[model samples]
Target: MLPRGPRAFSQAAATALRPPSGSAPERLCVAELPGSELAYFAEGGGGGDGGRPPRGFLPPPGRCFSFCVPSGPSAGERVRAARLHRRAEQRLSREPFGPGGAAEVLPLLAYAGPSGSRPEKGFLVRDRRRLPETERALEDLVRLILPPPARLLSVYEAAAAEDGGGGPLWRSLWRLQGAPESKVLLGRARVAGAAEPALHPAAPHLLDGAAVFASFEAARASLRECLSVIPEAKAVLDLVDGCPVHAKKGDFPVIVIEGLDATGKTTVTHALKDSLNAVLLRSPPPCVSQWRKVFDDEPTLIRRAFYALTNYIVASEIAEQSTKSPVIVDRFWHSTAAYAIATEISGKIQHLPPVHHPVYRWPGDLLKPDLVLLLTVSPEERIRRLQGRGIEKTREEAELEANNIFRQKVEESYLRMENPACQPVDASPSREEVLKTVHHLIKKQCHFP
Candidate 1:
């Protein structure tokens, strides 16, 4: 028997003392009292049995008392039992234990623990009020934990602070994580704090909308920088692996002349190709050249797809040759866009797909030409030129000829293109005069003597 409350004998002792098997034991018995409480007694000990009655039976002590409450908790027992369980939980929640049921308490421990003492110890704390202390701890921990290559803790800290308001200590820690060096840190910080979320911008010089385009440009610049860091031959080989355009081993200054028919492109390209010692390669090139036939026989979506596919093949060939020789292309990607846009203007098509659509690709990734000369001629002049060429009209050609309106729209679209690579030349003058101006521009623009 034991005193009640904290000193009470545990239920294990009582269970051990009970006989293992019995109907009720004849000498010693345990029973429930009135309100479902337990009582224990020795029955025949007073009988003075000279023989030992039961080997395991010990004489009951005087004034034996109850140990635990008799009844197990009933369904109706709510408040009292719940209060006890909650108290136990609260006590356990304050300590640090290994992962499992105890791991959940770590965040709370972090919040409640002492401030700024053990820097590593304080980092787990997430409370806003405790952030100052936590930040200081993180900085110290970073120095201890991070190797040189991985030490961007300061940079992270600075970036976080710029993005949203936090404690000064927290911001300092972020800078340690986010930006270790000044130049790299500042650039990242600005990018992180920019109005728009972009990795790169189209034009770094144009601050007004630069942020809008930065995401793409930043990624491109990063890739380029990474490539530059590698050995040149290795980088080129890697580029070839990723882009089919680099498969050929040739060094040529490839000039691709692109425009609608009767834009004086053929005349200018022949002259330019001769002057530059370039090969005049035309799209729908001899090999895999079905698009030209499609254009002549069946002008439909299928034809468009064929034309776009052949152009890519030709572009790839040009890119390969560009390694060694100067290659001139009569028409390239610009013609693709012009024709697609023209189809749309005629109300024959709506919503042209993006440049990378399987049917067509934007030539943006193609090898950049040293120069692109765009011949600009008025609708009337173009019409006259077409008539003078004495070429049989296709359906598209007839449509453009019948409605000067369509021709004007196509011309306007071409002029409005935003690529910096193209230089427009007026084709109203005689072919010879126009070619001379073009030759002069090329000499100046491309540094040709």
Candidate 2:
């Protein structure tokens, strides 16, 4: 029988009720209740108390609700009603929606939908079909910026694709697997493009061939994996052959003798060259013969330039002679620097630019002497030697003789040169003693004996 009055109660009951999959009732019993919609209860079974809620709904039992739909007076009808009521009881037993309900359900909702997009860009969306095209693009880019036989490309790609924030763009471009020279070229380009002020300011100064090559190789290896993902990377790959560092043979054993005036350096160097079977050379090569006279007469900044330029010419001559024999230089770059520094100390003139400073010559390119002998003489001994020589006085010589304090500073500077190859011979010794010391020191230091 069905009892009914309220539509809301009937709808709730209808939605909650269900029958076991393959069951059917013999006859349906209907009832009409007051003030509510139809509510049916089977007459059979202990569940006849459908007018009241289920025992599971009683206080302290966790409140529950139940609905019943009476079946016809047949065994199947009774079974169907019992099953529907059981399902309703189960539904009402569950806890009602609460604060954490939304959180608990959110994951389930997300699982039912498509995954969301990434927030940032510039990522490789790798699919097997696109890999070949992407790789080809990257290869082409690498060739554009780097020369043939890309030795560092693999390294670059690896660094570029590294996870854990391991790869930086500079590393990828420069340190890729490629020829060292090519890597250097690429590294320069990348460094030039850096946004940081320090990197930008330092790039040009730091981009030497050796440094470039090293950085490029490092960056490539570091960014290698990332490079593989950049599909348009071909722009950085191709580059034309450009200038490269090359080695040239030059005169060996160019021994340059340098010291303050009246040190007997010229006489000692000439004698040493003769004894060693070495070619005696002088700075301000004969090619700049007139400039040599100017330097001796004027000692001004202009004259200094002439003297400096002459050293290069002498270097050229020595380079040519080096193939045939070792060259001994009476005075070379150091003499130029010493005189320039001395002049500046005297407050007589402004100093030369660092590039003009003989010490400022390219460390890799300058002519390295096999040995240098610095003749040291006390001021008294040096002045005495000048008197003994009967040499005519020049204005510079007169000034030097007058200023003993200034002269001491010059001597001190020479002594502090710190060049390992310089050997100091005491000029106060007897001529024979000096020669013996020179010969012995040379044989020991140069392994000529």
Candidate 3:
């Protein structure tokens, strides 16, 4: 329910939250509010016998909205909050509605959890006149957004600010209930005469394995189930099925090269292949390259599974090739998990799962590399190289160019992996220097003569 109180909510705060009038098309506007500040605002509006927020304190129509808590009251309760926010934002942006009837998706407001943690929710404010439309949209959005294991409880609808009592009031017309945890939190808050909704805890960070993959085997099984839903999965899976899943590692060392796009991975790996006389391979290996675009468009779960399964196929190839020569992989599990984790967790790098978190661990069953080298270049140099290539960028590569937070998260995720953690290699230097440096590391680390 929208918070209300007799003290009259601050007009200044409302004005500050309002979207600026612009000549451009209607777009989603992100509004940031600390849980503490929101609670203070809600408490200031206190009224009614039940000690619920008092009515008639909201600003005028089109400007009234409330932020709700994620499902689960306790801080320890875990939910796919980041993914849920992302999925909801994606759905809402697709719809033709915003401040006006026609709208575009805008960047989400930064709402940090307690003590500046990952954002708990993404808030969208719609015109009250389109309540019916908003309700229908919410229903459809929820249908697509709630795919099980996601714990979003409800999407509350706020009435147009109504004039009564002392000031305008924002009322909760209704909530499309998806889970009961939200109600429990609200009930407790109301009972305690607290204004703030239950603030989510700071732990769980960005990469919660349970929220995505508990294990490699579990991810593969889930991918199979999603095959019916995402037809692209079959084409990608066919490539996976052709390879031997259980292959013995050959005598030679298997080295993986990891980095963001235009980070000299191709140049370095190719050079290493010639210098070391090693067999070259890559995930989403040459076999599935044709279908890469098809699965890239799929949902996060399906897309990640696609890439992950490819590694196993690559693993089989590595086993075979390593018998004759050293194996140099363009990208492998580190690339897969780094990109997936970075994309899944929104906001700053700090929002990423804590260092040494289980999500950063190497899969116990997957084939392990002898040594992994992560090539990094300054952002400016990376963009310069990207321009120099003139090749089409992968989805993540494109995002890497534009989103610093995302790029940082991917870099950090690469650094955080345990067991076979990646060794950093500065690729900012000349291509020849970079290769020479890598050659030294490989011979030193892999005991190559």
Candidate 4:
């Protein structure tokens, strides 16, 4: 059993897991905070009349987050009897319940244990009297911190902190209330395309079958459903209808260039096009590209479906282009799937769908690339290029700079892609050198002169 008190508690929490990455200073958990039960279940358990939780209290505890790592009395059995003993010295540092004052909050983390509680993590924000301002601030923070797929409706309320201060601790209400229906659909699986049955329905990104669309037909169905609500989807649907079900590579090779932003994809693809006299194409295929931002702002279902269909349209283009000369694509289904999978799952690289999970398999009906090259640069070099470009970064691009884990997941997704997995190329050198290396690979792989 873990020891109690401020010093021992701090050491135990620190040792329970590795300190979080990034350069943030270490802050210890409050001593009296104890664990999950003390923080959440004490003080009549938020009940008033008839022992029932108040209205607006999130229900079905499965959806709620657990706060503490199992330890001490809660170590071996259920922690129902443990109670927090509040001391005057252990009260929270501040209690900002002023009409319009901001309150201090802390981000919390808990380990998954054998007792079946999943690992839980999130921020605890103070509830405010000004509802509108509080809502807007929380929305902004959610957008900044979480990817679209992971965002959920939050619950805010007043509660008694274990220290006897009537401080509030809030958590996001997830999966049901305000989340997109597609989110529920996405998480229904074990992992996109996993053959094993999904035992845990509430698992966040451990989705089964497909993350976005399992097949082209599935993508078409989602597009058709969103036509009335998302008008821009009509263009995508029309492009899908006209495009062939499968695009067979023409007489020549179809080469695709892929990487994170500022990895010199534009420079290298253009150079390759010029050298090989290849027809260059990009997905959403210029026709639907104009509406890229519109769909990007939509839910993951609409966003990913739009991009997936664009790959089919590009496939048709590839068939035609390759017949005349070798084809070069700026980005294809690889970029679409890599970014989607990375954004859908959070935390470390290990949290990603297992290696060669069906999520990484190429769609059978879509045109497969003869060769896909992933451009890689040293982190310093990548940052240096981003600074030199002087263009605004996309949300994911900005995240790449701030979060190493997200960036690693994206690149790793590319590597794990099956069938026509990407071959990593060191792009840290000059543009000419990178292009030279790509040309050599294409010649050897495609037998192109």
**Best prediction by lDDT:** 3
lDDT of 3 at 330: 93
lDDT string, candidate 4, 1-449, tens digits: 22322234334333341223442221111111212111222111122123223222222111122123222222111111011101100122233312334533433333222233433333444443333444444444444334454454334333333465432322223332243232221111000101111221112322221234557886776567666666887877886899887778888889999988888998998888898888888766778757877876564445677788888888998988787899889988888888778765544466567776777888888888899999999888888878867776656678789878778879998999988999999998887888889989997899553
Better candidate number, 3 or 4, judged by lDDT: 3
Q: What is the lDDT of residue 80 in candidate 4?
A: 14
Per-model TM-score, in order, reads 0.40, 0.39, 0.68, 0.60
Ranking by TM-score: 3, 4, 1, 2
Top model number, TM-score: 3
lDDT score, candidate 3, position 347: 50
Q: Give the per-residue Cα lDDT of candidate 2 at 343.
A: 40
**Candidate 1: where are CA atoms >4 Å away?**
1-251, 288-291, 295-300, 345-361, 447-449
lDDT (Cα, tens digit) per residue for candidate 3, span 1-449: 33433223233225422223432221111232222112222211232223443322222333333333343332122233334554676566565454345422223333332344344444534344434455455555554565533322322222333354323232332333554322222221111112322322323533332233534565566466655555766766666677775666788999999988888888988988898888889886888888788767655545676787788888889989888889999998888888888765545566667777877887776778899999998988887777867787677888888777778878998999888989999998887789888988888888442
Better of 1 and 3 by lDDT: 3
Cα-based lDDT for every prediction? 0.39, 0.38, 0.58, 0.56
RMSD in order of candidates: 33.1, 37.7, 9.8, 15.0
Order of candidate numbers by lDDT, starting with the best: 3, 4, 1, 2
How does model 2 fare in lDDT?
A: 0.38
Residue 27 alpha-carbon offset, candidate 1, angstroms: 96
**Residue 38 lDDT (model 1):** 22
Residue 142 displacement (Å), model 2: 62
